[model samples]
Target chain A: MTHRTIKPAPNIVQGTPLDAKALKRGKIFLNSYAPALRYTWDTGEAMGRYLAELKNGRLIARSCRKCERVMIPPRMFCERCFRPTDDWVYVKATGTVNTFSLCYVSWDVRRLKQPEIPAVIEIDGASPGMGILHLVRKVAPKDVRIGMRVAAVWKPPAQRTGSITDIAYWMPINRRSQRTVSAK
Target chain B: MNERVAIIGVGVMAARPSSEHLSFKEMMFEAAQKAYADAGIDAHEVESFVTCAEDLTEGISIFDEYTPDQLGAVQKPMHTLTQDGLYGIADAVMQLRSGLVGLVVVEAHSKHSNLENPNSILNYALDPVYNRPLDFNPHVIAGLEMNGFLHATGITQAQCAQVVAKNRTHALKNIAAAYPMNLRAEDVQSSPYLCYPLRDAEMAKSADGCVVVVLAGASRAQPSKSRPVWIRGVGFTNDSPTLESRDWIDAQYIRAAAAMAYGQAGIKDPVAEIDLFEVDDAYAYKELQHLVALGIYPQAVAAGRAVENGESGAAGKMPVNVSGGSLGIGHTLEASGLYRLAEIVCQLRGEAGPRQLPRAKVGLAQSWRGVPTTSGAVVILGR
Candidate 1:
């Protein structure tokens, strides 16, 4: 779809940049407002049960009969199959690290002294490639690898809460053995 | 897809770290005025308007209510899409193609500097139950994805660094770019890791800017004084939003979007047919990842090697992000897609100034809604 060309027109690039001093000195009129909005999200049937299972030191997942894929963060319906999930299955706490990060910053961009190693752990009983996001702890950040095996470290029953945090974090399975041997 | 739609005019407020002097409305007005003038038509002539914005990012609920007055769109049919500006373009294109609207205006802007805790706002996008509770920073997702992508495709960290170096160097020639730099890939590699495997230098800093585009049906565009860039295809898609369910190694959303777009554009081979590209580079690795998803490269490793060998540079075989991309241009949030569209429009019209491609004809612009969201859009335009 070729057309007769007009000479390239000059672009209209307009914007005024300011420094911190400009705002501080009131050189530019500024209005500041902050909104504090609070929300209490409803954890639905699938996730509601999943969190409860976490509180009990177990991982729960839903299986899609149509696709035969077991999914975590269990949902009522299988998005791929467009069908309601058929059964709930308990997944093994031990899994391989599908991917991980050594996070040196907080959600608000605040620097942290100790890096948080967040990982996507593919639970053993779930379908291949299905994983949940959680922290991998008790191992040096440098030691974390994508394929390393890890198992969840759960809180004591007295301290159990219906939340993902009920499981403190995932630790390298090898490190768990080392700790057990050292304790013995 | 029924009738032809053409981009008659595009106006942009060059991206900056902050636009302290202009309010978002004022930026809109400025961009709209330029666009209307370039199109050689009054705002009154436009039949429909679409504004791309997110309420959380705007700090205003129902942000569409405030969009109309600024663009002379009062008492007109205007709606907002909580998506990237490329989606806005797609909306306008559909409106025009419907034969109901002869002309449409699309606008998207970023007031990113106004956000005090941008990362926290991004955190809100995560799944409240599963992911948000464990959130250190949402960018950890990027780190994990980069690591997974590298493992899956054998693309190295150094190759991703070269994407930063190439795009920043290209920004030097772009008058509208914000973070132009001339540095080696080592500079990016050595930069402190914000989330391990994802460095601070690899992420695009936020910028404030606005983009306005005017699109018209064949009847209106053929009679216009300005040259028109024809819209060949437009497509967008959203993959699974859940962290557990989605593909971490590739941008399935982008691939799906490109498939729909390339099919519509009759682009059997994107690498051979498209003259230039302005794909999302919110993060450096994203550039290579997107290239692979766009079907320009067979896989991430090939896309990575292409960057390493300077094959995607401004002067390379298939020039990608010659306009500096989000990396060098500063990420403008939702308006990013429009900024990419604006760059391609300028290049296709031979108006890119120093960064203009020599044989530009067909071009593609792609965008992704940043972290934790899998929504992405692609548009193809030909002169």
Candidate 2:
């Protein structure tokens, strides 16, 4: 048989579209409440250590002896092998871009004057595909690629805080780049 | 099993971009009233009720406290599922199969326009130390996953655009579809990018909506307004919640969920057995990746050929997202899966109008929890 009953129109339109003028007038406003909820998260044993190393200008990772997978932003246990990490390892500060996005807007939906190149950089010492979500800098947004090599541009030691932002942002290793002394 | 669950009636309402006409409670009431009336049953006959919603999406903590009043489910054996509406239906199926309840109603709704800061709200859902400090837009992860999925599957961005063109054009036939643009693959490519690879046009914009489905046991299936579509299989699973730890190539959770559902339905081959699919295509690339994950295509590489050859279209060999999907219709947060499920039920009952299939006996609906999480659900239904 051919089709019989077609479903009705999609939306349930009732009142007219509320314009900004009437909305701002607050004539029909019944209640007003702004939410402010706070939370305190324990960094746990693994992430707590990872943040401490970031504060000291180093990248930390953990290895699972069972499956031999190295993890960045280190974890206490291995997800696949189902075992606690067997060793602690420090991954290289420099890595390749696993993927990236040229964001024209901020998290709060505000358009940015300059687009931000946010990429997931796969740490050299971690597993082959494992990566961390962070920002890229010192390169034009158009020049960024999937496998581009980049190094972390850290904040000065005096200005460092125990946070992911301590690494300032990542910069592409261009031909004219100068070498910096390692933190021992 | 003793008996199968039946979906007798479904009610849904969605507005494009946003809905300024009605409040969230009013939206739920609209769907609830239609659903109950369609099922030829009243609110008093409903033994239990299941509502799907989340605290963060609604912006009001303990959101369920405000749900029951509108649905007329007050003081009954009512419960809530924080996940998608598919999960609520799955739970309701178990409740009815236990021979306890004769009638059950599952409800879910979305009010994203009211959210003050949706991005920050999503960021709060992320890990506090590693993810939040980067101040990343959640769409960036979708881009990253799109990269990994395509690189692993050898699917091109142009092919992904075909999915956008296919769905948006497919929406023209669906009256319920939200953003029905007359777009093509070139148009999708020419569109400005949202977060690299994932163009602003490809990602489904959130809209305000509600969905309610009435499920009655086979014994009580009589005295009904419409034919009951039996729930043949139901499955949902969780992969590693952390994106860093998951198999980023494809959705293992989807594979597992499909296996469970297909197993229950005695479906050895999905592409051959299932007539059509109504998956959560919140993003364009997701349709390609999910087809591979659901085992419709043997691997990700096979998806491109199918899409490019018009094999995944409404009249194609394997029709997918015929109700325009979330990309065509809007994604209604937790209610998305049920919205798709309702489409399948409508198609099986010969009620889908211009978008209906030639002959559909069995259909599948799949959904995934949005960004930074690897959890999904699947359900199968037939006439």
Candidate 3:
């Protein structure tokens, strides 16, 4: 292909410096210019309350009033229903791998120099369908298949927090024996 | 009442990834000016606004903060779609269809060069649960799709390379195209692999640019200085973002969108009805996948009948990617769709110098969001 050679026009405008060098320092400086953002959340609170249930080996979701659909990672409202959820429902922690990818790069070439395989898994239990975003470990990326059963692996009780990361990762659930290990 | 919506203006900036001089807003403003001038309308005349943006952490601190001032949309009804250019057009169309707004200005641009982890930012678009954890570069997904396309359709790598060569040749006439080079199939095949089966030349380089279009109602669409290419029909649909759940080889989302648009335009045979086409060739296989999906190429063509008959060019049945597409041009996110749209307008108005398809009366434009997501839109325009 013959690439177009662009000639810079004399009338082109300029802007404020992006501080390219300082950005490469990899450390925060005092009084560095950055934009401030303010956020509020009924959703955050719902997630907090829901994450609390996961530690006790339970999965919860919000059921919408208008559409009567359940939202995983429990939001206060349902997008499809366009209405507030009517009730909180508990779903099984087990699910199937919906889709996944094996990531080969790291941020700043940091820790875990090895790649990670991420996926979207649809949880099993409750109204027949709902998936949540989380990491899957203990199995090679190529060995994984869609619809393979998996279960949540929770962190130790002392390290528990009201967050999605509270579950260390999802491990392959042994369907042949229906065996699951309790939280570490 | 029938909706009278039309695109009354268009604008774009000279494309590049690391523009040393201008800010994102400056690039947008320059493009907006050209669109407004083409529409023969002032910025104040626009009743609503829809702008496309992505993560602010990628470049600016707040993503939406840079939109209003740049688009001249101060105090106007505006919404941000952190998606491709087609999404912005879809929003404007919906607002116009509701009889809620008459004149809407849509803006979309990308300034991705400043980000340190640009590849990671693209990966973030994947489903964080399964897809992102794998550390998969989204380009690999394109490879898989292309592999499937080749395996199923019997299309060779050389044929795919021909697409690149043809598109770049078409783009040589386009003033705004960033990488308009005369390339050969052998050269493209021998290039370094970004992802298996997809070489360096096959991928569209990240370029920073702005594209804006003024969409207006019927009365405002009356031709002034430049002919207004009417948007006859618009179609958009999204497939399961979960990649494993869908057929990666087939572009169902684009097919569905194209069906809706072609149906609305009363087009039963796209090959015969459409004159020119601008497909989302964000990846090499996408153009062929979309072509097959739209039924522009049927099973017989899939079996190599079309190539043997000397009917492979877009002008053979329907000329595709006449503006050289995102492949020859550049995929500046939201800017890409409007760039396709502008090319169609220019073609219909006989303004395209070398790329002007003879007797072009109608055109189709399509776009696909890159990876883990399959959101797409198709629009049919008429002179």
Candidate 3 achieves a global lDDT of 0.74
Where model 1 places Cα greater than 4 Å from the true spot, the runs are A1-184
Candidate 2 segments exceeding 4 Å error:
A1-184, B223-225
Lowest summed lDDT across 10 adjacent residues in model 2 chain B is found at: B14-23
Predicted candidate 1 versus true structure: per-residue lDDT over B122-167, tens digit per residue: 8778776677667478899899889888999999999999999999
> What's the lDDT for candidate 1?
0.87
lDDT of 3 by residue, B241-349 (tens): 6777778677889888988888788998888888887888877767777778878876723623443233545456557777878877887776778778878877888
Worst 10 residues of 3 chain A by lDDT: A34-43
What's the i-RMS of each model? 19.3, 20.1, 17.8
TM-score of chain B of each: 0.98, 0.97, 0.94
- Report residue B264 deviation for candidate 2 (angstroms): 0.9
Q: CA lDDT of B174 in candidate 3?
A: 78
TM-score head-to-head 1 vs 2, winner:
1
Candidate 2 structure quality by residue, lDDT tens digits, B1-383: 45778998788785456665555765776788788778877766788989999887776678778677667776778878889899998898999999988889999987776766777777767776566667679778889888888888899999989888888788888877677777889998998998887888889878777899999888877635558998999999999878677787888888899998999899998888899998878888988888899988766688898888999999899998888788888877898898889899889988989988997999999998888778889999988
- The collision pairs in model 2 are none
lDDT leader: 1
Pairwise TM-score winner, candidates 1 and 3: 1
